[model samples]
Target: MNTYSDLRLNLFCQSLLQSVGMNKENSLVVADSLIKANLEGVDSHGISRLPIYAKRFGDNRINIKPNIQMTKKSSSVLMVDGDNGLGHVVSYQAILNGIEMAKQNGVTAIAVKNSNHFGTASYFCQLACEQNLACIVLTNSPPGIAPWGGKDAFFGTNPIAFGFPTGNDQPVIIDLSTSVVARGKIILAAKQGNHIPDGWALDRDGHPTNDAEEALKGSLLPLGGAKGSALALAVEILTGLLTGAAFGPNVKNIYDNEESGKANVGHFFILMDIEKFMNLNTFFESIINLLNEMKEVPKIPGIDEIRYPGERRKRDKERRLQEGIQLPPSVEEELIKLAGQYNVEFPIPIPPLKANSIVSN
Candidate 1:
């Protein structure tokens, strides 16, 4: 394992992306999104993804220079065509547009099509929250989970996220995948030759498996069995079918090298300007009061504290900023290889600290 400061990782990622023909601005946007995930302790969606993304860029699967187009459909609705661009670039532009539209109107709904896999959904939600806008984000990926009572994979993990601004406090952000676990975590496990816990997925033969590789070749279980499947179906409809992007098994797998086509992933965002509905201060007070009351409720034995959704993530980011992000050895090796291939310099690993260095101090 190796640790690296966020700044070094950011520079390394930006250089690699630029080598693959991405613009400087777009590279920074993508790198920032990935690093933010790491800072928030979501390592599965962090720079571990860059190697695959760079491979896709080299294969011409992702468009580095995309002709993104936005169409205003109604007073509070819009559509975006990503032109097969990187998902981070596409979604960043979409959220910015949505935030502006929500400011003008009370709310805005933006649907994006022809984008590749975006990193974490929370990244975009944070962007909206920074602008003092509440937002709901949804995106569909290649098939990973099966429909209820089905053996074949038919739905993506299909994450959904919501963010609410709290004036002086950190915005309340909630993000979750419909699957029992994010497919990326399984992929990371496979890469590191680790076993997953049971009940997370089934083998290709429809039997439960702890092997990450088998799980990848099979189907992921839904978050809450049938109910999670139903929610995933709804996300597929909004992000895939409604957006005119590929859906179900038709969405191409990001890791499949044999199938050479764009991913055509879709994302949907709803942003609301807090002031439009109620006084911002009043809304903040109400939300804080509700959170405080919830926290004051009785707790089970051995429980320390009850925290709101985004509180832990905020703390994780602060800690990681001081300690640096750690990368698994396998992921580090792959990143080093990518750096060599791209003719860019990989960031030096942070030196490990020596114990008892302050003896007799």
Candidate 2:
């Protein structure tokens, strides 16, 4: 496979992301985060979503340069108005603000309203660890998952993420959707012209289906059976319900169509000062110990060695930076269109798979 260069890919991605509606700086941040997911083999959040975001943004559904200013601020809490801005851009700055606030207080809790979809939650949570803070992200998206035993969809993908700092061991960042698969999965399947495995989702009639188009018309199964459903609702309450944005059945996508008209999605971010809880160095050591213990465990019958939550991503980032990123045929086509729309020229496409870099999950 031919190697792709990160410089070219990043430039291409950023240009398109910005042309759609994101401010140049925010678009670059979004592009970098999306590319990080791709490098880590999480293609669903990568460039594939660009075209949809562009369409939504161009239509004035998602804001380009959101003022993300705080509406309420306290010693350890903040309330923000996203002003219908880009979720990624708003949430990224929100997390950074939370970290800074935590420095003055023992912890900081920030709730946001009027935001759109932010990519992987891990990206924002990891930002806290980069600055020696404990980070947690609560985000609610359009309803797509069913409450256990109930037929109708009642929960957003409703994701929660956690990040902790560590000394020698890598920072622990666990980002997950309460559903078996995120709603983004369906969007991605649509992009690749692929059909998902059955049992991943159910139709509007509550019957299992594999068609991405049909699943988009239906509800997704909760992860871990019922427990994930419970968590999904809890996250929705924090992110959407309480934040005054649409929640559960009311939330709609600003990305897809007129379907989710005027989406004002809400998100919550929290950052805890590690030093306030314990010595920063000591906290790192404890985290490192925990991760080290997990690493020593023998692989299960069919499992490989136990890896830390963000370890693979960190390694992938290092390798991909050297080897470059890849663009699939569909994504490449969209990027070409983006180039035309922005009146920009990009280098010839390169194959995604390469020597040091495996395609991101």
Q: Highest lDDT: which candidate?
A: 1
The Cα RMSD of model 1 versus the native structure comes to: 2.9
Mind giving the per-residue lDDT tens digits that candidate 2 earns over 238-313? 9886777888878776655557466778898888888898888787777778878988988779987889788888
Task: Candidate 1: give the clashing pairs.
Answer: none
Best by TM-score: 1
Per-model RMSD to reference: 2.9, 2.8
Q: Which runs in model 1 stand beyond 4 Å of their true positions?
A: 354-361
- What does the lDDT read for residue 2 in candidate 2? 36
